[model samples]
Target: MGTVRPNVLIILVDDMGYSDIGCYGGEIGTPNLDSLAAGGVRLTNFYNTARCSPSRASLLTGLHPHQTGVAELVNNDGPGGYPGSLSLRCATLAESFRAAGYHTHLTGKWHLSNEREQPADTWPTRRGFDRFWGTISGAGSYFQPTTLHDGETPVPLSDLGPDFYYTDEIGTRAAAAIREATTPFFGYVAFTAPHWPLHAKDSDLAETRGLFDEGWDVLRTRRRQRQLEAGICSDDATLDHRDPAVPAWEDEPEQKWQLERMEAYAAQVRAMDRAVGTILAALEETGQRENTIVVFLSDNGGCAEELRSDPEGADQFRRHHLIIPPTAPDGTPMKVGNSPGISPGTADTYTSYGQAWANLSNTPFRRYKRWVHEGGIATPLIVSWPAGGLTGDVIHAPHQLTDIAPTLLEATGVPALAERDGEPVPALPGASMLGLLRGGEPVEHDLFWEHIGNAAIRSGDWKLVREYEGPWELYDLSADRSESNDLSAQHPDRVQDLADRWQRWADAVGVIPYGDVLAARATMPTQPA
Candidate 1:
């Protein structure tokens, strides 16, 4: 038989730890994911942009977050709408696939655009995807969401009744969509599970209730060791401790709530894995499993944001003034906060395990999600194609989220289209990895990352990373993947050169555009080496 066009399945999990899955050597029960990794290549050094929306933007557009106008999160304004909304200048993965004669569908979180004043046309359907069944807002109750959408129309969670959990529902919808899709299809299944609100069914939570009660210290050590054994990190490298914000486990008194919260989070992951198994089964049943190129990854590192505890803009308002109506009525007074003592499963309690727990989640990586350190941006990437296209092995080559779009285009023999808006889209910044998947060396590209004041530049084996409030820290990733050594003093000249190159690239691609965030970024030292 003649070779057929490969279908694409991009499975995205939210806030997943790098070492949490069986493929990465953690104890998490992920049979489906492990099977995929065993059949295909397990990417050992895949890097995300360190956050959700930005990473998604890069993954879909083959460009940096700044180039996509979502350098931070979505910030909407007047009638013209949010600049952070999916810009017309860039072509999304679905847009390209649809142009290439493939059906496009998405079922999960849609954090890209949610501006009230913006016209309905700015949403996913008009943007590119043929169909979208998911939530429009950033994060919400997994059981009852505020802005759930089934394609272009608004849908209700209650429509599924009390039995509807968003994670399971997303998987079911995706499986149905996959089975019903005509011809070559591109399915982007983004799950927002294991992210927040620590709400899981009693039966689901029961699976991991006492799993985390041993505390963060033990968990952190265990995960780090496992990662080293899996070759995700170097065994000789030192694992960095938690950030200053995280309290030592020795100081923690109320351990029960902490344990329960993590149990709920783990349950979410397990449930998502079950969903993945369901979708994979659907693909097998459809007899398209062999020809399908399945790529699974998380957007960023484990999120440490305590929605109610942190004093930020929208977070502050939501934490202090949240009002859950008695029955979705007008002006029903309510307050939501992530208090330490309150049990997580209750409706009133809004909580996050905080930085200490986030440290445990990231294992050996230096920082959490927002920063550019290994832990903050590194993610587990598993790609499976069983028609003798992809082999089972571990690839140590560095990969970026931007590579996803171009990789898909290259694999399916699709061309990159011209931009719609007058603003010309930049050239493909990512190289094709088809050769690497076929057991050849993947082309190397200088990887760069920046979010607000945090910045990192990677060229070959050396990486220079700087946190918002921290000093410039350098590491030769070949020797120190955990970023435990500081080579800044020894390699000052190289640091200066790399920083300059990164700045020039950033300036060319609108990394620090004019905005409130830019105003703050402007105040930082013009050049730091």
Candidate 2:
């Protein structure tokens, strides 16, 4: 790196798919993200933990989510499996970098903590971030998100002006932080965009007005071909069939409604990319563009959480989801559903892109978020550090989110803290990919993942995976990146070996069976997670 201690910037988006950005084969206008990918190294086969909080826990701490006590959402599951709050036993990236003389700052989402009404130690400020501001919960409306905090203090809704938008605010604040940092800084921008309650600016919506009018059936084929042409996927890699539950575009009755949902989703992505552009411009204007180590990725795969017409009162809706606001910022009653009559892309409207659009988001893949399948876990990972000589290259390395923290620490010459809060921390199971970022060949390794009941283990080129309560299926991912063919019957022994390995890991990481975990949670008193 050019500077003695390079600045660090990690940009994380919520529930984005593998090929949603222009450089990755999607038709969306993501010029900023595409430019970032062109100026960095793209990981062709990077994976996440297949859920939000689990993936965030892994990415920040460099440990499996089970090790950090966040195997699932920040729910009070009562410990049959894991705790909802992040364990202080493992030091976060901010803590490590701060200990090494960096001014650590966090902007946007902070779902690691389960504390809703009462103050909790797991909040971002107490986690070693010098400055922190964002939501403590998972998902909500972009117009008026609940749980807005500024370093442990809740931000009032009145302060967010009538025209405020969450995605825009997240990017704008992050850029301001970067420009104000007087020392080498470690900034984390966690954008909750393109997640749910799809809301976008009028201009952004205009850009994608008729983009998905043809619907998912035709778009999947076009996207897959683009993926192959761009070398994001292998030439022989075939697009998986559309999700079984989704009706064909020709067979569907709500064609106009479906098209509108996708347009809003596309607009959300474009808005996120525009935010990314501002962050990048901040790096450039501050003269830290080359030396700054910038990384961009989504926390998980595309979300399929469909929002339907809700009959609950506004107060009842707020009672259920801690992140959801009861009304719009202007005190307008929000329409919380994907009702065909309620056109989205406005402050008073709340809706998701739904399953059919999610299928297009995860084009060429079978399952959606929360599954251990390729569509659920696969994500685009971009690492750029011009001063470190890692630019404009592709690494076909099958890595996971756990590798991120270690890689950043290594590049910045910082050590993962050996101990925290007067207790010893465990060693990070993830190895640094800093070497690979700097033109080194990829070294094969085994990777494992579990969420809810879904499980997967990738060993070398062979992957053994299954849905919750489903049979194990094996695939040679080198030839079938789409995971269309299952080879379990032909190689039962390999399946057995991988399964045994996965079991051993689960036991080591405190993974309880999905049923057992749910049974435990059911017995506990319910609270906002």
Model 2 ranges off by over 4 Å: 310-318
Mind giving the per-residue lDDT tens digits that candidate 2 earns over 1-529? Answer: 4457899999999999887888888999999988888889898889999888999899899999989988898887885746788998999999999998999899988898878656688888889899988888888778778888888788888888877889998999999999999999999999998898778888898899888778788898899888888888888766687888999999999898888888888898998999999999999999989889999998888888876576764345556657567777667777777788888888788788887777788877878899889889999888888888784777787899888887888888899999998899988988789888887877677999999999999998899999898999999988887789999999999999999999999988878899999899988887664
TM-score, every prediction: 0.91, 0.97
The residue-by-residue lDDT of candidate 1 on 261-359, one tens digit each, is 777777888888999999999999999999999999998897777656444532444532111213211233223445564566533344555666667
Top lDDT model? 2
Worst 10 residues of 2 by lDDT: 312-321
lDDT of each model, Cα atoms only?
A: 0.76, 0.86
Global local distance difference test of model 2: 0.86
After TM-score superposition, what is the CA distance of residue 172 in candidate 1 from its true location, in Å?
0.2
Minimal lDDT window, size 10, model 1: 320-329
